[model samples]
Target chain A: MREAYHEQLNQLADHLAGMCGMVADAMELATKALLDADLAIAEQVISDDAKVDEARSVCEEQAYALLALQAPVATDLRTVLAAIHAAESLERMGDLALHVAKAARRRHPQPVLPEPVKPYFAEMGRVALKLAHQAEQVIHTKDIDQARALEDADDEMDDLHRHLFTVIMDKDWPHGVASAVDVTLLGRFYERFADHAVSVAKRVVFVVTGRMPGSGDEEL
Target chain B: MREAYHEQLNQLADHLAGMCGMVADAMELATKALLDADLAIAEQVISDDAKVDEARSVCEEQAYALLALQAPVATDLRTVLAAIHAAESLERMGDLALHVAKAARRRHPQPVLPEPVKPYFAEMGRVALKLAHQAEQVIHTKDIDQARALEDADDEMDDLHRHLFTVIMDKDWPHGVASAVDVTLLGRFYERFADHAVSVAKRVVFVVTGRMPGSGDEEL
Candidate 1:
């Protein structure tokens, strides 16, 4: 019975990692749509979001079932609880990617990225996708160092986000107000996408160390 | 022992409702700051967000303790799980309010809302505050009808969000590119704030009916 419960917990982790992969794929495609004005890819990302949402619902239901039947305690309990939170974080990441895809679709045929802002958004996309991939690995490995490193990566995304604004706020911004609005929102979607990855990584660290990330020496 | 566990579960609900109240207050103040250019109120909202975060942490911890110690099953287990999700929703609402405050601060001494957009945002604020208050009631009453009504209110917010873009995209948009960016983000913040409220309400409906809200007769 104990072995079975442990196996269930492992399955929950695997499901979460699966979610991370889906989000990474969605962001990768959504970013491509944003850069190339590929309407088909953007639409695909939007439709694909439902799959992530369904996976999250399944994951959470499994969690409730495990708790009800197994009543896991101590470390096992924390692991399941963290999985629930991590599922939520990943679901939100998928939603953020969906938002990115929607933005791309809204500007369909007309590239959402003004030429000046194109390179910055391309970098944001790469960073966001990389973070998602790294986050999936952290979910499986529970590497505390790697989880902490995701935070540093998030800081880089933030820098990129700030620089994006500078380009818009530049006195010589060639694009009109509408383009600036789209660019600002696009920057936000990518920044928030990275933020969710860091959040999931933090939960993974908590699962491993039983110490909430950023809680320092304070034990949970 | 059963009675004690039940009492703990009630406390968890109370904590969640308390979070809803804090988020409502934060949005109210943040909106006021945005319209009036009140830096102090914006700063107050920003600083107060930590309290909401702490409250959510406490609420989740209590739920975890109840699950671990009581080993609740069936409806009781579902209630605890819903509380965890609801607490997260409220915490995110608080974050959205914090964002509204931060945006106001960014434009400090200068109102974030241009004159043409002021009334629109003002209405958004009222709608958001109304939804938050209604959401608090839904948390306590679990009134399925009221919970469902929150979705209609969310539709109202969505309409307002769309209208905001229309105003921004108007040929006579009085504000320049930067102001348009600010207004667009402000609209998004309010829309998302209301969205969190609707999500919490849906969870409440699920708790009461044992059928997922929007799932209709389909059982999850």
Candidate 2:
């Protein structure tokens, strides 16, 4: 029974990593949908968000059961709690991806990105996917260094986000108001997605080291 | 020991409600800062956000202890878990309020909202505070009815959010792209704040009813 309990605890991390993988795929597809104006792919990303939400429920229910039934000790208890936080962050990442897809769907035939900013968004999508996968690995291995690396990658994404904002706020911006609003929200979506991925990796670091990265106990 | 555990569980709810009250005040002060472009008030809201983060740590550590040492059963287990969720939501609401305050500070002495949309933001702020206070009450009482009422109030917030967008997107908008971007993000910050409030209330309903308070299981 004790052996099975430890295995279940390991499985909780596995579930969180799996959910991160799902959101990564969702964001990748959603980014494609946004740049290409592919409504079908956009809809798929939106619908698949449910799977990510379900995955969170899986992690959470497992977490609650572990805490209630097994009475895990300090480190193990912290692991389960961290799983809860990681799962919620992954779930939110999925929502951010869905928001990206919705932006694509909202514009339908007209591409959301106004040509010049297209490559930036494409890069943002790639960075977001890479960060999510890195986060998954961090959760799996409990690698504090890899988790710390996620923050550096997130900084790169933030740079890209600021780049997009510059394009939007440029005095000579040609896209006008509606397109500007779309880009603003889409930039925020991608930026927030990366932030959550970093946050997920930080949770792993906290589980292993009991210290939140950055200046203090709280993370970005 | 069990009796003390039960008392701690009750205290958990009290702490969450207190945190909600803090965020509510933060948002109220933040709204003032935004409209009046009050740098001092904005800075205060930004700094006070740490207290809400500390409150979440308090709730989370208490929860982990209750789960590990006390081993609460089913409903008690769910309540503890829900408290964890509620605390996180309240912390996020505090962040959203900070976002608003920062927007104000970013354009110090210059109001974030234009004359026409100022009332919309003012109303959004009012609704956000109301929803948060209602959420605090629901958390304390675990009253499903009060929790349900939060959704209706959130609908009002949503309408105000949409109204802000309409103002931003108007063809004759004189605020320029920078101001439009600011309004878009600020509108989202306020809308998201209210959503978290309703989400907090929903957690209370979930603890009481074992349902997620939406069509299937997702709250939002």
* Alpha carbon lDDT at B1, candidate 2: 91
DockQ, every prediction = 0.48, 0.65
| Predicted candidate 2 versus true structure: per-residue lDDT over B1-220, tens digit per residue | 9899989998888999899899999999999999999999999999998899999989999998898788887888889888988898899899999899988999998787888988998899999999999998998788888889988898898888887788888999987998899989898888889888888888888889987877221222
In model 1 chain A, which range of ten residues has the least summed lDDT?
Answer: A211-220
**Residues A1-220, candidate 1, lDDT per residue (tens digit)?**
8999989988998999999999999999998998999999999998998899899999999998899999988888888888998898898888888888888898788888889888888899889989999999998898999899898778888888888888898867877888888887888888888888888888888878877776211100
lDDT of 2 at B50: 88
- Give lDDT tens digits, candidate 2, residues A17-105: 89988999999999999989999999999899889988898999999888877878788888888889889889989999989998899
Predicted candidate 1 versus true structure: per-residue lDDT over B1-220, tens digit per residue: 9999989988998898898889999999999999999999999998998899899889989998998899999888888888998898888888888888998898788888889889998999999999999999988897888888888888888888888888898877767888888887788888888888988888888777887866211100
Docking class of 2: medium
- Whole-model lDDT per candidate: 0.86, 0.87
Question: lDDT score, residue B199, model 2?
Answer: 83
Candidate 2 scores an fnat of: 0.72
Q: Where does candidate 2 clash, by residue pair?
A: none
